[model samples]
Target: MNASMGPTLQTQGFYDRSTGTVSYVVWDAATRAAAVIDPVLDFDSKSGHTATRSADGLLAFLHGKELRLAWILETHAHADHLSAARTLQERAGGRIAIGENIRQVQTTFKTLYNLGREFLPDGRQFDHLFADGESFILGDLEATAMLVPGHTPADMAYRIGDAVFVGDTLFMPDVGTARADFPGGDARTLYRSIRRLLDLPGATRMFVCHDYPPQGREPCWETTVREQRERNVHVHDGITEDAFVAMRTARDASLEAPSLILPSLQVNIRGGQLPEREANGVAYLRIPLNALRTVGSMPARHGSA
Candidate 1:
């Protein structure tokens, strides 16, 4: 239970195959108002086909509950998922928001993706660009965006009541925190960021963005600071900064690229909206042939060791 909390916050997770990204819908039980976080827009890499199967599921859930959606919140521009937030905003009639630092990420990737000069990195794509420590409303629930960058320059954790929707910062205690090897990612910085999250109240329920199934357990996304501190292999209570960095660097060095890294970054940096249609008015995403040779090569790992 939350400390002096009022209406309970309900959360559900949905996974998309295109990038193995997990999307969530969180709501207030009393007012029947809700917010979707990191919702997925389905894409088929082989056929170049994109759809809304996952987003449709979220719409179905909202419809079934008769909840009024107030906003679509993204923790950051994901590098392994295509957010269906805009699509949901259109259907659910709510504003979409993300961290203000997203503009930096957008600028970095727009050049990488070779988007035309007309593409702006001013964060106009999102309804609102929240600054660190910014707070907003969702019916009876009060949510604040805390800047916890490491996995990416714009990554954030949403403190909704007693639960923090920590995008990809810290995972379930048994699993540990997200890797910091992507563009603009740093293991040392991630060490500091994870500490910030751990500094929260021990009882705070941490909701994760994605969960890779462990040895034999089903995928899950909820944990707590205490549990993580005591059991998380990477950053438990007494872990030192130097120890964490060495482990993180060695581990990150052995991991493979996210299956959808190439596509995820390009779409995510644009705030989930796909590229504009061509003269034929048909939208397309580019795959730079062999561009990931060395500059973009992913380290190969032996699973989650």
Candidate 2:
């Protein structure tokens, strides 16, 4: 997709049709310093093959414009696709950052997946952990990390200049919001976080992490705060918090698990590090037998991995 020019930030979105994810590369055009958000490492769950095509695509875009990479930020530990943060960091030389609350996410999944005690949920895996309302520099553009937990305890939204990259907290007005049934997810919290985003100036542009386009429409990832407030079916004007939570909770119960949840979390928890190699230098993935219950089978239990 062509880049959109914000007041001070240049933004572009890449669509991964395989997982319905939209990764972004944002930079200060004047300084050419850039950061990427929620990059994907292409993983074929059926065959267990991982590829760097998606990350490489982002690199090509930055290199094409001679942008200096500064940060690879994860909005959260995703459940739909493996993070390409480590791969991007190695090639682009940028710090990897996520919300400090990622420790809680790591801990929740650690026990569920039976990870060893060697794995500490201390938020040390990433190069930096951002606190709520934290401010930083991405070239000349001022960036702030806003804690927007609901889809996951670690979820964060990055506000740069007049644009905000909101991961999984929202979708196009017609598609409504993301599901909040993941461990540590709460519909009530998500509603408030969304209100905060909507309260921004009407012209504030918003970007989303994924887009599930309904039939007969093309995928979209950019919308203005005003557009959402006026049209977002799930949380638009007059939608009470009680109404949102009730609607969101009921909807989530009927949804099936994300196709990549198991594989994604294992790599995501370690900052996108694959499992350690065994004596034979082969890293194997574990598949628990009937350990997970699908939606409507039983209430999903939360745990520490």
Candidate 3:
């Protein structure tokens, strides 16, 4: 367990290789009150099986540290992996939260997925919906939520003490930034949001949500604003907004949609709760035919048996 410690706050990151996601546990040293950020729910798309291994590991860590879970925070509704937020809240007794802009995301996906009258597009699915610059108490430490959209319209970064949990806005310096091509994402807007984050104190600790390492390099999730400014290949100090946008747009054009986007969003938009079970008690995810242009041409149709 690799942990970074401040005078009053402590942070430990849990990286899941299957999805390249890093979930964090941050706490106030004085009270042992903690929050879990962007936890992953293990999902096997082939078998349509879901497991609690990742969430269970977090629960075990909290129990071992004698930490009380005060919050289960989601950086955004993810597209690559299922979230473990609802499961963790059920097992540990903490409030689940996401950015208030999630209502926009919910509205968009609800239309695409046809989530019907039962699923409300409002942000009520979560225990709390944080607005930009909102402040809340985590034990004895004061934490603030910063709106950092562009990777998605609802992305948020949580700043607690000297550490900042930046969710998908930036990655490790060697890996660069997230692609701004998803729904409601804009390359120019992403550049500005990243610059806003770079404005923080140079020495502030920055923990990323995902890390896609290059050849011969190990996975890493932590960096600092100073290092990112000096070394981030995509948005270093001298890279202008125009240059970043041009590069991001071209790169995003070549990229395919996330493999689990269909399943992940359908579940994530519901605060990690699976869709309501059918009459046979099976919950199923919907995949709209020919909806995403990024997907290849449709297969030739064949007669049914």
Candidate 4:
């Protein structure tokens, strides 16, 4: 533990500014045991190429620090970048985990994509489906999964020690929070979730999943609860529930959908693993074409251009 009374969390962030997704390797320095949160797999949609460059960066960092990986945790099925969890698990030796509600997400998307009966929506694709309030130990470190579902029905925030890795739930103060316009997203519920996170001990540190600063600015992911409470534009301490909902709703309505949304949802909802490869060894990504239009236009969310 740090002298400041915070858990001794050694975190090295590997940011893919292209997708604006941050993959983290966090460990307890003393025990040399680690967990990787949301590692990215570099996918080239144009060339249909998939590479492990992003995850390899994390692997190299872990080797440098001499830490053994204990678990691979996903904050939620991401909608922006492909997850390298499977590749990392193969190289790092740990089981993959996600929120139990992923089954609900998978079932919803599977039907939208018209996937066949062979696909099981029970989250069996993942090694572990963490329930809300579930706690697990990593060597001496304790990590708790909190259901903070607003970005999607299956969103989760991992509270490891005093530092919480809030996926799309909230961002650094300057960036505001994630949009609540995806399937199953509710602005009111998101507000409550943000409040719950802010209520954590005033000193608790928040490690956000992504950060996008202005041109030439470096991405910053670590901030304190006290700082967010005082300065977050959308959910600062004095913002009332109704006000936040109104602000969030208005902002969401004006935004555009994520560029990768079409391809992302189909793959992410299945635990970051790609869809079953088709015959001839080609992996096919199904696009519902006008399906999203029928569901209503999606407002843009933060992350990726």
Candidate 3 lDDT tens digits, 1-305 = 46889999999999898888999999998999999999999999999999999999999999999999999999999988999998998899899999999999898888888778989989989999999999999999999999999888999999999989989989999888987878788778888899999999999999999988888988888899999999998999999999999998777766767778889998898898987789999988898977754332212221000
lDDT of 3: 0.88
Sorted by lDDT (best first), the order is 3, 2, 4, 1
Residue 280, model 1, lDDT: 98
Best by lDDT: 3
Off by over 4 Å in 4: 1-7, 293-297, 300-305
User: Judged by lDDT relative to the true structure, which candidate is superior, 3 or 4?
Assistant: 3
lDDT of 1 by residue, 208-295 (tens): 8877767898667778878888898789989898998888878878877765667777787767778889999898787766555444
Candidate 3 pairs with clashing backbones: none
Instruction: Provide the lowest-lDDT 10-residue window in model 1.
Output: 296-305
For each of the candidates, the C-alpha root-mean-square deviation to the true structure, in angstroms, is 3.1, 3.2, 4.8, 2.8
Candidate 1 vs candidate 4: which has greater lDDT? 4
lDDT of each: 0.78, 0.87, 0.88, 0.82
Deviation from native of the Cα of residue 105 in model 1, angstroms: 1.0
Models 1 onward score TM values of 0.91, 0.95, 0.95, 0.93
Backbone clashes, each candidate: 3, 5, 0, 2
TM-score for candidate 2, please give it: 0.95
lDDT of 4: 0.82
> What's model 4's TM-score?
0.93
Error in Å for residue 268 of model 2: 0.6
